[model samples]
Target chain A: MGEIKTVIVVERNYLMQAGLEAMLMEIPGLMMVKTFTGDEVSLAGHIRKQQADVLILNPLALKEDPIVFLRKLKQIGKMVVFGLMEKETPVNLQSHFSHVLNVSDSKFDLQNKIRSVLHQDTRPGNHNLLSKREVTILKQVVLGLTNQEIADRLFLSIHTVTTHRKNINRKLGIKTVSGLTVYALMNHLVRMEEMGGATK
Target chain B: MLINKNMKLADVIHHDYTLVPVINRFGIHLGFGNFTIQEVCKEHNISTGFFVIILNAFHDPHYFPKERLQSIRLNILIEYLQKAHTDFLEDKIPEIAFLIEKMPGECLDDRKTYLLIRNFFLEYSTELKNHITKEEERVYPYVLKLEEAFLKGETDADIKKQIQDYPISAYEAEHENVEEKLFDLKNIIIKYLPKPKSDKLCFQILREIFSLEKELNEHARIEDLIIVPKVEAMENALKLKGFGNG
Candidate 1:
């Protein structure tokens, strides 16, 4: 068995919370840590203490502003949040979660859902792997072109170029020009000779 | 754990030793064997409420009581933020740079890679320095001056001219994302650094980078949560009073 991934369910509906908990137990390597009605005072404080790996929150059940509360929870540390969506939840609140699970998901569906999230969490390449567009932008970046110059060369709008550049930074996790240049060199995205002008 | 005034200073430090540097920033030195938080603050001539709030906010990211912070004087917050900037530039940045500088010597085979990483850090340090300089030289003074005019319910022509030329909202809009580079630097080191002879120095560098990143985030949060909104409110109030040309 792999490491036990603890989970906390915060749903206002007792039946729904119980059902989620029961199904989660059927999945190997997952431990149901706690369940909250979501209106409990200092739920944030309680949840912080529990130190669970995954928090399954029904966004509508949160007494405090869900967006702000979830954001704070995220800032606390690495916890994968799965929104327990029973009905229509606002887009803003839904954005806080990594994935959403329907109230009616069966045990098999639930197992798959948890597995995918856990896999993504533990997977190293899932985060830093650059998309094709990101690689193109990164190439332009290492070539020592300004945003405007890149935009012109690539026939992309300046806004698109900037967004792509930001995404490249986020994907590769290398920020400085030299850092990115080194990454490109290591990955053979560009040769050492290609970066001589920009790196020095 | 939430901090309160009546708790013993020693116990508070025990609760989160990371707060030692935080309290130190407030000029509260160690050696009080049994001073309560309130007593310590009183001795230091610091507002107990403000001290408690700053400690809690630093200890717990979610603990920021926005209303409580907004009520305090902006200059107090600015002064604290300025101290954080000074700490970053003078202590934290140099400490990290020294660690990175040691890397090339420690791993001669990967000297070029280490040097590239060092250069990246140097560039980031320069950017951070410039960002801090802009805040200290321009943004902080403008905010202090704005607060003075707001408190007096009057703005002199000079203050008005400053506002007309560059409003507080303008500063808020162009607040550079100075911390983003640190995120990238951390990722590069952790994920892509060529195999080093020893992981010891890399571990230390990553630790310092993480600490600096956390502190930088908190500093940015203070400005976003407290300074910007208060300044914007004051700007609106001044405008309503016919203080500056829109």
Candidate 2:
């Protein structure tokens, strides 16, 4: 059990909304806040007021072009906006959404996707995501060193450095150097001087 | 984490220590600081006003106020964002390039195929770089120019040629997601491509991609959520004041 992610579903189809709501009941780490079938909430403030962490909806319910509405929702930054699309829309909704659920994906897949999306949702415990070795590697990474450079500096082989780096990223679930640098700085693994992105 | 100037600087570090860079931006240095944030910043010639807004913004991005935009220095925010773009272009992208390049030599995969994959990534990376470059060259300068004009009490009639035709909203409509292409690349490697001859190297690159995704997401967040909103609000205010044509 973790911080239950508050979710609001707004699908244009009642059956679709009901099906999603039924699935939501089985999905752990998520609590339903509101479910609407149609004619609800074109305003960002409605969802913001719910203090929701994720919105699962067909943008048609929002009464605008789905793509444009998704952009507006993203710009609001109130929560993770998950787009519900049927028949594979042409837009790369992934660009605007945390995850886009095609109706074709299985219900099981929906549960899995929701879990993965909420993986970094800042739960109460288990904040320590890196091991000692991983922490050392992360420090090197933030200092703007390549894997090869980090390997030489640590007196480790290039292969070993890559292995450590891989495990570190896997454990922490972060992908970019900038992301790791931010995490490292947050966790005190790296200093301000180490961050390449830091402004002078 | 809640922040107040009177709170021990050391305490804030303990709460979310990643703020080292955040503080350093305000010229606060390491090695001392039983002092209040205000005292330390004062000694270091940092503005408490600037320091406070940034601190609040970092600690709780959701709470960043449109109201604060008018007071916070646009130059500091823009400069910081621009430098971050450079860091991505110069450091992270090339680092990924090197990792991808090394795969061909170490892996048992056909050299030609590996080179092909590497080239594909380089091209995608080139596109991403261009996206960042466009934002820096086109959008940022316009915002800076707008800020300068607003502060000087200039009207739309005065600087219509400068930027009345383009708005920050236009850029937001096409903002980049640092994770998007990398997400495609990762799926290709994991699901579509043949098993990597060196899984460690592959995963290492994936890690870098994740890092880039996270970093870029944060960067985009700062721009999209904070800076863009701030700029747009300023533009709206100036327009309403009969300074600029909407």
Candidate 3:
């Protein structure tokens, strides 16, 4: 890898932030530049000043509108924006971000996603941002619901759920549905316990 | 003499009998009125997490369904408290045991132990503040709304629909904040435990810190499992009554 990338983790959860910090510390080429808890209001100025390479943002911090904050992060320039999408992330809001990571993803997949996004050789490609359908599918995956379960829950055909999963994996460069499940938990999508319901 | 569920903390404080139990348990004397749990915690050394549990018990809001509290039978609460105490002992006892091993050869200073104890309390207090703010401002409100809706006999669909509009994920996110602070405080204790230069004061401070940790851990559990779920139910009830939107 080139020079180690610095990451500023902006998460609302104290425990998750500490855990993420510990996990990130174990990674080879990633350094946690700083970490802040709570919403963008408490963090905007500090993040702007720090100018770290990546800002790991928990979207739940945006009490009013997350898109506005995402846009603001984008405008700051040179900082890669990765959002921890909640389970109920609105459809309209999904389109605005460059890359969306579900909070439910596993530790291994989360590290992989972070590494892939941070170390990608090319200048950030047109971020294959997740669409509304993709997010819903991802949520189902996080819940460990099979294609059949997802189809039933969302009132769609099994085929559609599979297609959504495929699209999601393709866009995110993740290989398996298991990878998606890990992504969902680490990113706080559906929570780990909820997955037991859909895992079968 | 029973206070209504809608009664404010100010209202409860006005009743001498109700106020006595609150003051006795919390060690904070509120002069003649119902005060919010936040106020009570601030007055006492007790954590707001502990106070939240007591508040929910007092005010059976929709999100904070009475059922969750009922589920936490005395035996279960005692078991949990025991486990929490055990965890504290496991974590701190070793350090103290080691300090005791070294105490005879090394001389311990009271100043050093006092400094360490002070730092421990400071760190604990900081974490407690952050944890309380998140619960009061986000998690408690959501739970209260949920409880309110459920109490009104709203269908799951109606509750789901209402929740979809307001969302509970944010409150969960706030839970993560509390977790991080707890971790930070733990690290601080690990880092700052008095270097016992062969002294009894170090042992004394260690014991106090260990006890404090035990109390705080139990407080956190009660808030997370009991108060949080209850508040969610109350919030649901409020939503059902169309009083939660504001």
| Candidate closest to the true structure, highest DockQ | 1
Model 3 C-alpha lDDT per residue in residues B220-239, reported as the tens digit of each score: 54554455444454555555
Query: Candidate 3 versus the native: TM-score?
Result: 0.30
Question: Candidate 1 residues B1-246, lDDT tens each?
Answer: 898999998999988888887888889888989989999899899899999999999997656687799899998999899888888999999999999888877753566677677777888899999989999999999999999989988888887777778877677667665665777787777777777778888889999998998798788668765787788788878877865343
A61-110 per-residue lDDT for model 2 (tens digits): 76666666666566544477778887656676545666788888898898
Off by over 4 Å in 3: A1-81, A84-113, A116-200, B1-222, B235-246
lDDT of 2 by residue, B1-246 (tens): 668778878888888776676666555678864888888878887677767766766665333454564456678778767766776778778998998888876753765456545755776687788888898788888888788877886655534554466777666555555453465566556544455677888888888887766556556556754577677767886777764343
lDDT ranking from best to worst? Answer: 1, 2, 3
Model 2, stretches more than 4 Å misplaced?
A1-54, A57-200, B1-44, B48-71, B106-108, B156-158, B174-179, B243-246
What 10-residue stretch in candidate 2 chain B is worst by lDDT? B61-70
List of chain A TM-scores, every candidate: 0.58, 0.56, 0.55
Better of 1 and 3 by DockQ: 1
Q: What are the Cα lDDT values of the candidates? A: 0.80, 0.68, 0.55
Which 10 consecutive residues of model 3 chain B have the lowest summed lDDT? B57-66
Which CAPRI category fits model 1? acceptable
Which pairs of residues have clashing backbones in candidate 1?
none
DockQ ranking of the models: 1, 2, 3
The lowest-lDDT stretch of 10 consecutive residues in candidate 3 chain A is A37-46
